[model samples]
Target: MLAVLQVILLVLDIVWWLVIVSAILSWLFAFNVVNARNPVVDSIGNFLYRATEPLYRPIRRVLPDLGGIDLSPLVVLLLIFFIQQVIVLYLIPAVYRAGV
Candidate 1:
């Protein structure tokens, strides 16, 4: 059970980094800093989009438009942070106390 919680933490960490990278890559693409025409870049962009889009879709539906600024990534990151904090601060300690 402890191992499972640890694995969940690891997965959350990976997702947090994925969201950060996706946001940075998107900014790069938007500013023309990276060539979207490059096959490698395109592939990476597509993979990131596919990985993160499902997470973003629900958040996007609830948020009002901000005039071309997307806040879904930020919202998702915050949620990930909150979940991590809960696991680390509350759930882990509770598990430790329960010895399971």
Candidate 2:
């Protein structure tokens, strides 16, 4: 139904932001801009890792090694954007036509 698709869209949006935040946090950690030793920072990093790792793992497996670069987050964000577009441009319209 439309409601279900909307929920899916909402979840995707949340995930999209999480991925962005995780990526930014990673860069901060890499550049030593954030203190990893601090309990608060460590906890936030761990939470983000746990939240996004499952989504990134599969993509990481398929992607080629790029030395120090990690592209999984970018790939995940693209896939999420693609899914959101499909849901918005096609699926929702179809649902409307079907009177659901």
Best by lDDT: 2
lDDT of 1 by residue, 17-98 (tens): 9999999999999999999999999999999999999999999999998988999999999999999999999999999999
All models: lDDT? Answer: 0.97, 0.98
What is the TM-score (0 to 1) of candidate 2? 0.98
For model 2, which pairs clash? none
Tens digit per residue, CA lDDT, model 2, 35-95:
9999999999999999999999999999999999999999999999999999999999999
Question: What is candidate 1's TM-score against the reference?
Answer: 0.97
As a whole number from 0 to 100, the lDDT of residue 32 in candidate 1 is: 100
